[model samples]
Target chain A: MAYIPSMDLVPGVLKGDTRAVARLLSRAENGNEEGRPALEEIFKRAGRAHVVGITGVPGSGKSTLVAKLTAAIRASGRKVAIIAVDPSSPYSGGSILGDRIRMGELVGDKGVYVRSMATRGALGGLARGTLEAVDIVDAAGYDMVLIETVGVGQDEVDVARASHTTVVVSAPGLGDDIQAIKAGVLEIADIHVVSKCDKPDADRTISDLKNMLVLSLGLQPHVPAPLDVGARKAARWQVPVVPTSSVNDKGIEELLKEIDRHGRSLKESGEIVERQAAIAERRLVKASEEMLRDKLEERRGELSVLLKELAARRVSPHYAARKLLTESGFGGDK
Target chain B: MSVAQTKADRIRVIVAKVGLDGHDRGVKIVARTLRDAGMDVIYTGLHRTPEEVVEAAVQEDADVIGISILSGAHMTVFPKLLKLLKARGADDIKVMGGGVIPDEDVVKLKKMGVAEILLQDTPPAAIVDSVRRIVAERGAR
Candidate 1:
């Protein structure tokens, strides 16, 4: 069969066609220019699904928990989709997308769609076009969209910003340097999931996370914008540390309840609007940066003369950059 | 995108084992070898139904499906897989397999739309080269 053009598949995608959704995601990961318009159309239809991001240290049992969570979510009669990511070999550029190994439970369940993605050289624990992949699933009318990123350390916080609610999972033995993880990763969690709670020594990890949350709560002050003061008038949200034994299927239902509650709270507090704006700003900045990079690539030939000057130190790096931006109609100031 | 990945040379392959085969070592080896050759491989661990494997390939948009069966179900597995692929409008995603099959079954398998059948004795490098070739052929199609 000849491949279907992306634009021609837009209606299928909008109609929740699995094949179309899958095809579009592949194109996005490949960074195909032909898929751009289809993605644009698909993204405009997004924003209905609650985008939850799951990130934690490797071996934190992220994939297992995601599998359990998706199953529980389905039992509640909600259609859920998972974008599970695993790392690509830095050497081979190929990856063993083994999240499917753990997610095997969700297979053949029509209500739950799972797509295992290779990080494909995209960093920060996500695959290239991760957000776009989320949007594609979201546009397909999945009630809940879960993005499980490659296990991340302190600085891989991009998933937090890209998602409406971020769940940071940590196994009992993973976080030895609590302070280092706290400084970067802990604060990003809307919910802290202590997975592998069935194992011994789980109590200490739970207590430690709760203590960290309590300790951090008082130190970070909320700066309400003029418009946000009204939204902030709602009761301040507390980050909950939920411990779960995904292996035992214990606490799975309770965690789902908490997620539901959090969703309602976001809307009732009118903070969903604020979150939407912040997310929009982030997306705008990211998309603009993406465009700039593409433009830079296109103008590489034009940049050779400037590159020679740069190599000779005749023109400062800042001057050449500003000149190029201005000449490219980006309105960079002189 | 990560600067490490070379565009235009990557392929996504799903390496699966269907039926009651607990022997996954061979499939895992094939998966790893393909990965080393710079093809993304999704390993559908032991004992998947034909439904699960076909759905996986379509959902992952894989360029090829490599099934390793040691349970003597190649006759049933390959035809069913190809049928499901055709039914889902995904026969474009080529299918191949290998296992303890008699030589006669290999010829019949190929005649029934199975792209390539690797015997157990095939070299690891040959396995990678064949998959790479299959993916390139799909691209040309």
Candidate 2:
């Protein structure tokens, strides 16, 4: 069967058709070529939603925190979409996405849309299709888009590059405070949340995070280099460590406020535009790489012949690669 | 909006447990089996209501909704789910189920729009084959 892009998909997505939105995301996740035009149509309508990324170690209650945050965002009369990226099973290429279980409360709410995406071997603790899915949700007019990573510690920093505000989640009693410092999650955090703060050692965890933040800030405040020459010099932002216990419903309101405060700071510092530009750059680079990969695969027979020649010591590996590049029209000059 | 046609890609399935059933060992295994068969399976975790399950099926555009209920609430959960799916115009989604269901209840559930019911003894490969057959039947329609 010839693959035909769904004719109504772009229109249906704009009309807030949930099924169409899901279909579009599936196409992107599977790397379907037909999804490109739909994405192009959706991209112009994006950039309105605030994309927040939540990442933490497994069992840090990241899903619970996301559920609470979604509720809080909904309470403010804004629509929210959540993309929970789960690790895929290497044996089957399938994922047991249980994040939605913790987020059960938000299931029937029309204002909330939750999707579970598989990492599909992208290896950066996020599904390769996440950015496109976010764009689909954004175009569908959601007010906030929350991306919860697979939370494999340092590898989750990809979310920092993809989101406007990256909230790093942690919990007490797991030694995550030290782990966070060691894993450098503290460096990428716009807001650090210590979930399950009702535990006996919650206070100690909170204090540990506070001390580490202070030490890190004093030693060397990690900041991305400004992309633009006229970027505003804003005040030094303090990474607030908020203690939250979802069981007790404690500190959720404070956490929301801190997120808002960080958003405001980004806007005031003119960093939001810079961040969006960086995200766009990343997307373009990824798309170009994917196209190059596809082209190489289309020429797999020739590439295999070149590889065999190199393996037989008939030609240098670099020379074969340059020849292939030139033949593929990518080399600047022959 | 026009009905979205099924792509030639892998079939998508949503595996869920409704009501207070916390025993998900059976459903998790089924989900893995379907996924290994090259299907995209979305497991909606545990303790979901019929409404939540139907909502997920609709939002996911799943070709199948496989429920694993061990709480013996098959009569309540299955019928309610059928009614909800009908009400939401999601009749195209095929519903299959398993996990400790009585023989009599399985017959009744089939009459109430449940497509297939696997018993506890059904092998994982059989479950995968059943899903493929159901998806193929649906696509043919």
What would the per-residue lDDT of candidate 2 be over residues A172-227, giving only the tens digit for each residue?
Answer: 88774456454355567778898988899888888888887777655552544232
Cα shift from native, residue A130, model 2 (Å): 0.7
User: Which stretch of 10 consecutive residues in model 2 chain A shows the poorest summed lDDT?
Assistant: A225-234
Best by lDDT: 1
Every model's DockQ: 0.53, 0.32
Badly placed stretches (over 4 Å) of model 1 are: A175-179, A222-235, A294-334, B1-9
**DockQ, candidate 1, vs. native dimer:** 0.53
Highest DockQ among the candidates is held by which one? 1
Mind giving the per-residue lDDT tens digits that candidate 1 earns over B43-139?
8788889999999888888889999999998899999999999998889899989878999999999999999999999999999889878877877
Cα misplacement distance, residue A293 of candidate 1 (Å): 3.8
CAPRI verdict on model 1?
A: medium
- For candidate 1, what is the TM-score? 0.90
Report the lDDT tens digits of candidate 1 across residue range A149-181: 998878787786677787888888655765568
In lDDT terms, how accurate is model 2? 0.79
